[model samples]
Target chain A: MTMTFDQPKTRTENQTRTGATVEFRGLQRSFGNVRALAGLNLTVGRGELVALLGPSGCGKTTALRVVAGFEQPDAGEVLVDGQDITRVPAHRRDAGMVFQSYSLFPHLSALDNVAFGLRMRGVGRAERRARAGELLDLVGLPDQADRYPHQLSGGQQQRIALARALALRPRVLLLDEPLSALDARVRLSLRDEIRRLQQELGITTLFVTHDQEEALSLADRVAVMNAGRLEQCAPPAQLYARPATAFVAEFVGVMSRIPARADGATVHVLGRTLPIDGDPAHGDVDVLLRPESIEVVAAADGSAQVLGAAFLGAITRLSVRSAAGTTVKVDVPSPAATTLPVGSHVELALPDRPVLVAPRKEQARA
Target chain B: MARLAMAVTALRGRIRWSRGVVLLIAGTYFLLPMVCSVVFSIDVPGQGVTFDAYTGILGADGFLDSLTLTLELAAATVVSVLLLLVPALITVRLTAPRLRWVIEVVCSLPLVVPAIALVAGIGTVLRWGPDHLADTPLYDTFIAIQDPDFPVVLVLAYTLMALPLAYRTLDGGLAAIDLKVLVEAARACGANWPRAVLQVVLPNLRGALLNTAFLTLALVLGEYTVAAILGYRPFAVWIVGIGGSQAEMSVAVSVIGLLVTWVLLLALATAGRPRSARTKTTAETS
Candidate 1:
């Protein structure tokens, strides 16, 4: 679905282009013996929003911090607008960052907090306040200008934080898990709001989040990291449909691993042979299948019995165990799920699309 | 039923009878001596209820000098200790957190050392400095710190004595707020380290700073052992010295000093409250 917002009118007229291209070249950071970023390289195009999606301790936040100039990379150079700022101090860098924690200055009123950067830049009081007021209105919190951060709700505080980050008109907006601290409903709404604002302002942004859904929904491209390395960087549809690595396939979405035997370019699973998606492997292998990709039908003499069913709004996920003791989860419409009760026999089938297969040992490691 | 009724009544005031009784006893214990002191200061033996003792405090010998010296020492101690501890604590918290325990131990070491021992050690150092460095340039430095007008030595001692209290207060404040996040946010907003600390960190720590200052001030004002043993006449020592000559006047001065300390505490508390809280308080009252 396409969502749109009016262009921000308060953006200064002189600032014709609001976004700047950011490049990370061989960025490496280490905390004692632990390597947070190892020779990482990625470039964000002007007006592009790239979400760094990874599990906890996967170095997504570390990468974001390195770009914000908070953490010094052991060996890399970060360039914004083609200018190297690796050695620049955090305050000197023009990267506006919104942290995961409640980062609004508790002592300042909302308006003053949003105007802080302009104040640091020596902007006149009247101008900064007017700009701050406009930004507050953009965030839909104009009436909350006089309130302190403690007086605002969590979602409101984050909205103010977003306004504060944008107040400086920074070249690149860095969000380090900004929505992770909020509740689920707020998270979804703020996720859309952030995407809308980013699009409206046309600011190049680096959003780091552990949630794949958030990444896929909001980012132009999602960079999946695993163990301090970029496993894959692609558009959400491509990343989901054609994951470059086993880690990416498993991490980006839920994948059911069914033991299969591979011969050359095809693998046999569930009494059917399928073409291998990526690398051709022989011998014992595990084929990964998305829950929705498997077609499930109730049959009186089916080989599998339904173990459990979990209702998830429109779709219900059913856990089924084959006669061979292999358990696979399948997603079917809630109406069809009602017909397949627990202990009922079912049949599963895969489509003609190539299936991702990983060696049993490699799948275990991933 | 009677006990239950009394307990419920006490609970409505947010103080149980047991707590109320304990507070009443403690108040009496602390206030009885001050009441007697006031009575003694006002009631002359043969003359009825004279105000001469209270009024004569300003005219008393060495009163103004001692008071001035005490205030200076208190101010200097507050500044020096905050200067020494604030940045150190913040740096340790932000950069080298593992070393926080070492600083805590060092700051708290003064508490274990007795005042007499500390003064004796200072006296030994003072006597040793002149004897060993008589011909050296350092001899003059030793004499300057011991100057009676504003003894830098006493200020140093009081700063050491105030370290534990100041560290705990500042540490508690730092703990309550996410110091790293706040500083990073300020830095992202284009504030340099000094500006971030001065404008963001210090304002947030206003309560802790005021509390540390008050504790140091009270400590400096009431300290007699170190100053007296070191042969300095700060207010506390002056009060003791006057007690030998005029008992009623000395008691009156002590009462007034206590009252002044309470007033200063109240002022600091009101000043340290967050602006929003203060505004709300004013609004509520209105």
Candidate 2:
């Protein structure tokens, strides 16, 4: 998707097809005893914004660093525009990166910081400054050009950092938790701004973030990683609904695991027999269900009692305990949730969607 | 209530008085020796307060040569020490951070080894080099380093002596800013490692670099034991050597040397401050 913002027409015209495809083929890295990337193979299409989402120490940042050439994979190759750049030094890679910390050169003003790459490339002083000024305007901080990094607010520093990263018109933009240092309001706004700029520039970007909402909202695809491996790589809605593994289901969104007995193609969960989503698990298993998928009805003789209710704007999450001692969370419309207060008994029902099941042992560990 | 208020006021006044007394004592303690030195340098037996000792400083034999040699040694020491430590410290910080303690221990080793002992070891090596390397081409290296015109061995010794201070100041500067992030950012901006260190790292470490240079300059200017023991008549040794025949001249030169060191330190301090900070200071002062 290409977007045209209020930026100077000439500059936008110059960036028409700037993005390059990035592919990580069997990338493997290890730090002493701990493996960071275990034979990781993934590809980001041209102009795609793929977010590497995982918990801390899960190697999301390591994978992004490998692509940016800050790190060399132990055994695999990283290709940009189908050219292997696995051994290229970071300076020659032409991959622009925004760091989690405030990486703006504190000694330089915002304009100079943005123009640093142009200067390194031997661009003339006047042209570099003019281009930097335009980039500052793009990030909505044109007036802050003369201000040093220490003088600007944290959010403004990040905006300049973003402009600086974009100044090179790099093949791929690597965002390593760029908004993680900002507060919630700034993070939300910058997240949108990054997405808008990425779309406008059509730059292929690999954003590493542990924030599930940020990944789901901004990414064309979210690659969920766990323990040095990609759990699942899919679109936001698909990854949310049809998570390939139990780890992906739990990591991507809120999921509740309840004991179930699977036989053949169906699983009997919460007094309802439903078709299994993936490979059928026989005998005892745990079924994973989204809170919104399970419907709760206020019933006097229901087997489950509403343990607690959390008002979440449009929907209220009700934590209910069953007679069989399994706690399940169900999301109901706030207005209806008022009728099912804590201590009130409710009957739960599932729609016709196939439910994913994991072995009971894994559920116990989770 | 009035009595209690009076008591508190009296207590505050007593504290202020004590602070004043402490300041006066410290000021006298530091200033009295310098004041006596200046007085002794100027006072003559019959001419009352003659300025001849100060005036004769420029025309004194071996004065300018020794001072120039000391400055050259200082410049070479500063360059050698910074060149050696900056890259080593940065590399240690960036890659093998766990080996940081190793650098620290090595740098700090010079501080514990007495100057006399260090000089003894160097003397032994210098003496041994001539005998062992007499037949080899290295025989000239021993003679070349011992050149009284500009002893390179002194620069080597000064570099070793300045390591601990240089390491601390640079390490402190590195700690104040995130070195890894800055270098990575510079690299991402298309700056190679050398460019990154030269432009980004060094600029941010301006204060620390100046401080390290000043300390090294001071050590070279004031050092007497190593140069004296090694039979080199640098500025400090010359000042001490003339004490028997020209006591007032020696004291005058010492006083002038102290003043020069202070001026250089002040100049460096002013230069090291950020332009914005200097402007702010000027505005506040004005």
Candidate 3:
């Protein structure tokens, strides 16, 4: 960890992919007796944006703070490039951070706020201002350099915060729920803006957020954490499509548990035993099916009664009750989305995608 | 019926008018004595109303010295309070919670122990002995009874009364701010705590601190108990002494104290507060 922290390398766009990298090694931190991070481990590759997706109190922000050196880890180390910064003081660590509040200096103009870090590092006023102006322009706030924080809207302040973080060219940027306070419209707009900036700079970034759409859309890989543990760390599609555990499957998106009797390779659900993905024994297990996978049809052939339906633009979502009284949702195109009314029979089909399964109530992690 | 309604309306209007008159009369009654002091300050010593009272005040033997002494005392009090109060208030803000309460109680203890009692209880105040302040001791402070620089003693008495109020006002101002904005903003910029406090947090507290300073100065200007009891030659005491022979000059001194206090308090009241202290929570999720 120490070795990596000392020599964080960012290639000057010589290649398309190389820039800052962060590696967390058995990082552990605690607040008094409450363990915020219990042996947490994750890595954000150079130029890669990784979102630490988790529920509240799941230590996702704690992990980010530890990496940023705001909160010291009781055990293990945080390595940027190859140097360990577990014991590094927050200031000397020189990591860029964008906070949930956008934390823009209230008294400073947008330009000066962006230039503040450079000035702190002993950069001259003229050069720092020029650089700050450039960064603000990069963030699409060129003419707003003179605006005080209150004069700008919420989105602009966040953009300024990003520019300020990038001012000193830190190897890794930590965003602690940086967009958690904006309206939905602004959030969507700024999320794309942040993604674009990250790609352009090729700077390693660890974004912490509880929003699954944000994590899925912005990150190259999503590290889903729950209860002080990393449940799954993989590309967003893989996290949603092939969740490693029941916790990850539920956390990433909506899922349901079903009674399944598993025999070595195949699991039987509702009298249909096909190929199962998990390695549980011939007993009851919970299965997770994505809404997109299953389709409802006429009840004569595996049909079930429609319990309810939700109309999402471009698609319609239906929850159908099977013959065995199990309800499952299926999302179909808007044109064919009309499902059987409540109490009307409908058919449910189990597609060939590998379904995630977990042991019953008393079972351990899958 | 119409004629009776008109009479009732007239009665109500008359009652309202009389109430307003009563209030105006009472307000004037309360202000009359203070206004009379200002009016008397201009009354002539011999025959007519003139600036003689003002002139005679400066011409008096002890009055001039004490006037100089009073100005010096006010200055010293302002300086001392700034030196002691500002740092103490700041320390209270940054210290750990456990120790913060202890320090607060200590600063407030001076107020709890009445200034007169504080002066009386201390062996150093009542009886002068060897190895005292400058080998001289008189009551609360040596200067109050013997040093002739009455302003110094008066100012010391002012600190005893004003320190707690200053702390409270500043603390209230500090409480009104969102401290997290400063902390997180500084941390995000790689600023250590000290730099953040100096450049960010303290600047935000300008209104509060300045208000405290002006208030302390005003309190120092009006204080008389510690000076009078300790044999200090403060302006208020001198004004009291001269009221028998030269009432006009004494009134002039009273008017000066009132004017000085009013100005200081007005400055405090008009100080500008931080306009941008709210936390800017940008986006909830993105």
Candidate 4:
């Protein structure tokens, strides 16, 4: 049997296919007293996959649903390929949506479920069946087409749901937490498979998720949202390195808040002066430093004492308490951290580059 | 190990005692009446037990006519109840969900209004309708509604009476499936409102439809109050009318009617098993 997981040419071929640009302009939606989407503006380029990442109740789902035509924004316009489609019904918008639940029609066989959209479009029986078969094969489930939904595993059912959504050849694909229900291992594999299929189709896609690793690993760009507003929208590396707000910095990865003295374009922390990115306030502020950025050295006269250490394959994370009674975590190579055990004294140093610093009042528990 | 097994056996005995007691009580409560009916139907005080009373009804006059009419009314009741409830339930659930309690109350109104009181109200309307509508075109409709071949009034009354049962069954089935999501999914696939309801929603509710239909069938088959009061000789009324003359045969007929109803209910319960489960069983057997 030939393996189909490694093919790469489909991404480019899909780029030339019918990938439409989707734009959300000044969208606002509210439910009772809670605002779901507050003047949201976002643009997804042709054939681009952008992940809308946020915690639950962050309105990331509401924004995605607005694009799918399942929800209407109270005061904004949604444009597909520069044409206003705010008033269009969901089915007529040419947007394929895969829900969080499997959402398969329990009455239909897997093949029939995949072919449902085509049937709705009035396609001929034989033609819809043939196309559905091809889609089943693409999702690596050709032999299970005759099985009912209950007979299939959860992963298999989701694959059929994906095929059903794609059977219509929609202009935009909307996936709302599609992998959140699966087991961890299945979630990883299926997410990669979905990403591969999406790239292959080259469809402009909006993927809503609460998983940071999933968003970082799968999307061409990630839009981090909070309280019905987009906090930062950038590529994964840029989002991680230079978050626009303190919320994004805390949400994206592990970072320790260290008290620091801030001046114009510079912050003093750990007895070292470091240039600060963006605007640096001239007062006491919180400096956010990644664990890897804090260099740890073993010394008898060290100011910090190692509290605990955890060996994580290639790297070891050390928790140390400094002389100022502030606890900070540091990461080093396993071989390097092996020498620094609990109760050992260590000194902490800072990186020379510019770091992200925010006003002290903005520092809240993530 | 012996002590552990003994403890498990004691627990099992306790569970079996509770289950067996409940089963025995239920069996006696329900079965004893049917057993008495069978014995009363077959036993002749002066003669040995025989099925002469059971066979006696085959040759009785008006037996076939009443049975045929009741079956037709049951069929009409099923069709009318489904047409009225399914569309209304779907529309209220998918669109104005705030009106759900109102719809539920309306569907169950027949249950609160006793059958005798409801029949009295309908009787007044039927009697006063022609006089009030005199000289108007609607006067003829009142006369036409009392057609003997197929009494529209009887069918109407039965439909209203069957509403609560049908509504509860359909609503339960709808609750089992995500109705809004299914409809939206279908609409997202290019189906219109009616097509989505017919194609996607209805197929998923096959079990509910069958249950409602059977419940209505059993109801209309045995209902005598409205039909007898309206001066229409439906099967139940005919059985009562014959009981005044031939008591044994009528009792036998009642036993037969009970058997037929039991068969229908058994079939309905079995048929309500999901198609996927049925296919799995078939495949295993094959």
Q: Report lDDT per candidate.
A: 0.90, 0.90, 0.74, 0.87
| Candidate with better lDDT, 2 vs 4 | 2
Candidate 1 deviant stretches above 4 angstroms: A1-14, A361-366, B1-20, B281-286
Q: Candidate 4 versus the native: TM-score?
A: 0.90
The DockQ of predicted model 2 stands at 0.60
- What lDDT tens digits, residue by residue, belong to model 3 across residues B57-162? 7678798776667677877776787678666656566545457667568668877888777656543543554345464443345434355644354456677677
Regions more than 4 Å wrong, model 3: A1-19, A278-280, A298-305, A321-327, A362-366, B1-33, B44-46, B59-111, B122-160, B266-286
Task: Give per-residue CA lDDT, model 2, range A1-366, as digits (tens).
Answer: 132433554353344557899998888999999999998888999999999999999999999999888888999899999999998899998689999999999788889999999999888898889888888888998787777787789999999999999998887999999998899999999899999999888899999999999999999999999988888899999999899887998888899888889997999987778999889779989888899999989999998899998999999999988655778889999999889989998888889889899888542321
Error of 2 at B99 (Å): 1.7
**Model 4: docking quality category:** medium
Give the candidate order by descending lDDT: 2, 1, 4, 3
**C-alpha lDDT (0 to 100) for residue A190 of candidate 4:** 90
DockQ of 4: 0.58
lDDT per residue (tens digit) for residues B123-235 in model 4: 99999999989999999888888988789999999999999999999999888998987887777677777888888889899999999999899899889999999999989
DockQ-best of 1 and 4 = 1
User: Quick one: ranking by TM-score, best first?
Assistant: 1, 2, 4, 3
lDDT of 3 by residue, A1-366 (tens): 011111223222223333567888887777778877888888778889999999898899998888776677788888887888788777777578898975777777788889888777677787788778778878888887777787889999999998898877777888889899999999998899889888767788899999999999999999999878788899999988888988888778877555677777778775576677766556777666788877667564444667777889998888776554456677878777654555667667777656667786443222
**Residue A64 of model 2, lDDT score:** 91
RMSD of 2: 3.0
Per-candidate DockQ versus the true complex?
0.71, 0.60, 0.36, 0.58
